[model samples]
Target: MRPFAYERAATAEDALRRHAAGDGAVAYLGGGTNLVDLMRLGVAMPARLVDVARLPYDRIEHRADGGLVIGAAVRNSDLAADLGVRADHPLLSQALLSGASGQIRNQATVGGNLLQRTRCPYFQDISKACNKRDPGSGCPAIEGDHENLAILDHSPECVATHPSDMAVALAALDARVRVRQPDGEDVVPLERLYRSPGDDPSRDTTLAPGDLITGVEVPAPLRMPARYRKVRERASFAFALVSVAAALDVSGGSVRDCRIALGGVAPRPWRAHRAEDALRGRPATPGSFRAAAEAELAAADPLPGNAYKVPLAVNLVAAVLTDLAGEAS
Candidate 1:
């Protein structure tokens, strides 16, 4: 790792100020789970580190509207174990538990997890040409080792996929990301926080350079059965090949409302809006689930090696919705 100046900020304002003053490649240190690993791999070369781990953004507050506001600094494990979260947003809890091992979950913060970088191998190898790591550079993953890459909404410039299980749940729950900008604070929908690679793969999120993520606000609880299912190469400590986070509200043998978001298949959390539209007011049957999943996946443009993901996603979505529907009954 390169030598860098390190400072701990007691407040968000101080952290932003320090970040703004830094000459080059300034990064906020949260759990040091992702950023430190990137530094070690020479993929990230920040000139200065501002430790935001000590900031007072570690609480989980219940809102009067029956929602919850999760502080950015709250550890992943703590968030998953929170009684309110497990009871109200079981999907989020399940997604967190399905992610990295206990050690990593203990160190990874909610904000950090949302902002974590892609696990693309090419992006991590400094010697290789990765458009996400270096703008204008060619993306080798387009033709090499792309089986685990994106299958939807990927640009020619980048095929990498976001690797956050928690973000997938947030997307399904229609959460808002709270950020502290230099001029003022802003609340952005979690879905809007991420951007497709498009022509500039160097940028991972829509957040401005100095914007600090403060917390996330989930709207009123679904009050419906939900599930987060992941399929990976191993039982644990592995990234998802395809994952689904789904919530369903069924009434009288029909679907009243539903939300589905996919991971390991897109640059951002792939909110299955098309599927939701198809499933709403429809019979909660295996056939209906399959059609909805297909409707959402019809837009997928998978590479030759990853075409299997389409069927995998289809089956997973159907199974999760069917299981949830059965439980609802």
Candidate 2:
């Protein structure tokens, strides 16, 4: 609970200006669901809070091509309940609903959801050595309680998993983030938006100092069967041990096209390109599904505590794709 100045911005320009005026010590407020929690834990201490929740980015626009432009300020509950979202991109809607509780979802915005930090105990404690919290200090999670940490695309410096269920679906859908940056506006692919911990575990995203996510542009609907399945320690409110967001298209008992993205297994939403490549043109069978999933997970390098995530992810992927294949059949 550090003392900080707060200002509400009426426009994106205003928000950016306010952030700049803070001299790089500002955080954009969007619902305050995740950011506030971190602040209370003393993990984040911003000198100023630019309230971007009031910005004019609160609408979900339906494109003629069956795509959608979802505003950053749109609440998770609203996005999940949108009729167009339910009918067209059911996976996205399903992922949103599967996340936090109804009350939290009511206040959590799309942008905030994407920006939520990991729930890693070491990272949150502040007393522990967390590379993400203090670069080069060390990542105790690597040898500490890492049962829920990453198994894919992880480095020795960091094994923390991205906690956004919505992001996994967006990666599968090939969504792009529209950002208002210091230079100008740019549309960045969802996959490119995040970078692996690599050598710099402190930086979660590729966004520069003054980049603001304006909205997410999901490309045209798949018009095919899709599913989002999550496995957690509990029934609800718990983060996924492993989650799969998958869409499959089948014709003549063969896979036509498919997209897959994995969460809770990597530093970012891991697009299962290897799996997709293996499944395309293959028979739409459980065996094929398993093989594709295995191909994608072959590169997994898991720690002792989190090694179970590898098999969990493999089975979850096969099961989800199987369910979607059944629906298509």
Candidate 3:
């Protein structure tokens, strides 16, 4: 690993000032889970790391409106083990437990998970040609081992999938990120925080050079039946092949309201707006769930190697929604 300086900031202001002094070559360290791995691989070579893991943002607050304000530094294990989170937002808790291992979860933070880079092999191997690693260098994954790559919102420049299970649940919950910007604080919707791999694959998120995520604000719980289901090659420590985070409200055998987001099929956690639109007033049946899944996946454009992801994602979405509908009933 390359030599670098590290400093733990006592407050958000101190972290921001230190980063600003580094002139855009500094990275904020939350848990050092992802950043350290990238640094060792030489994929990321930040001149300095401003440690923000100890910044005064490690608490999870339950609001009066039945929502949550989760601190950026809250460990994944803590968040998943919180009784309030398990009762109110079971899907989020499920997602947290489904990721990594017990030890890593204990060390990983909410902010670090959201900002984790893609696990694309090409991006990790500095010897390979990866557009995300080097703009315009080329994306060999397009014609290489892309069995786990993206099927939606991908461009010629890149086909990498975002690897955060937590973000997918947050997207379904309509959570917003609280950021400490260079000038002031700002709150951005979770979906808006990520960027699809367009012409510029180098940039993963919409955060500015000096922006720091302090916390996430989840809206009031819908109290509907929700579920998070993931399909992977193995049982543990494996990223999702396809996953669904869904909530359904059924009344009189009809879908009253719903929220759905898909992971492992897109550059970002894909909000299933088309599926939600199709199911809002439809009968809560297997056929309706299948149709809704199909509607959302109609725009999928997968590469030859990963074309099977399309049908896999479709079936997964349908099955998850069907189960959620059953719970609602």
Candidate 4:
């Protein structure tokens, strides 16, 4: 790793000030799981490191509205094991548990997990051309080793997919992200945080350079059956080839409401709005689930080698919705 100045920040303001004092390439250190890997691989070359893990953003609090306010510094394992989270937002807890191994979960923070970069091989290799790493350098993943890349909402400049399981759940649950900015604080829906790689693959999120995520706010419990299912090459410590986070509220013999989000298929956690629209008020059956899944997959623009992901995602979505519907019934 390159030699860089390091400082421990006692507060969010301190961290922001320290980052502003450093050269433009300063990075906030939290858990140091993904950032350290990037530094070691020479994919990231920050001039200074501001340790924000010590900041007072580690608490998980209950909101008066029967929701949750999860601090950004809270560790992944803690969030997954929290009794309140497990009891209310079980899908969120399940998504966290389905991610990295025990050791990684213990060190990964909620904010860091949401802001982590893509796991694309090309982007990780400094020698290769990756638009996300070095803009205008071109993307080699478009024609090489793209079987695991995106199949929806992808651009020619980038085909990488976001690798956060927690973000996928947040998108499905309609969570909001709280950020601390230099001017003031702002809260935005989690689904709007990520941007498509349209013309600027270098940017993964809409957050400004100096902005810091403070916490995530989850609305009141759905009080419905929900599930997070992932399909990968192996059962443990593997990235998802296709994953689905779904919540269903059924009334009588029909679907009253539902939310669905897909991962491992886009540059961001794809909120299946089209599928949700199709499923709501529809009969809770395999046929209905398949139709909704098809409606969402129809917009997919699969690449040459990743056409398989289209069918995989469709099947996974259908299966997950069917299972959740059965549980609700």
Using lDDT as the measure, the top candidate is 1
RMSD of each: 0.7, 0.8, 0.8, 0.8
lDDT of 1 by residue, 1-329 (tens): 99999999988999999999996589999998999999999998999999998899999998887699999999999999999899889999999999999999999999999999999999999999999998888999989989999999999999999999999999999999999999989999999999999999888899999799999999988999999999999998899999999999999999999999999999999899999999999999999999999999999999998999999999999999999999999
Compute each candidate's TM-score over C-alphas: 0.99, 0.99, 0.99, 0.99
TM for candidate 4 is 0.99
**Model 4 root-mean-square deviation:** 0.8
lDDT of 4 by residue, 1-329 (tens): 89998899888888888988886989999999999999999998998999988788999998776699999999999999999999999999999999999999999999999999999999999999999999999999988999999998889999999999999999999999999999989998998999999989999999988789999999999899999999999998999999999999889989999999999999999999999999999999989999999999999998889999998998999999889888999
Which parts of model 3 have CA positions greater than 4 angstroms off?
none
Better-scoring candidate (lDDT), 1 or 3: 1
Cand. 3 Cα-lDDT: 0.93
lDDT (Cα atoms) of all candidates against the true structure? 0.95, 0.93, 0.93, 0.94
Model 2 lDDT per residue over 71-103, tens place: 999999999999999999999999999999999
Candidate scoring better on lDDT of 2 and 3: 2
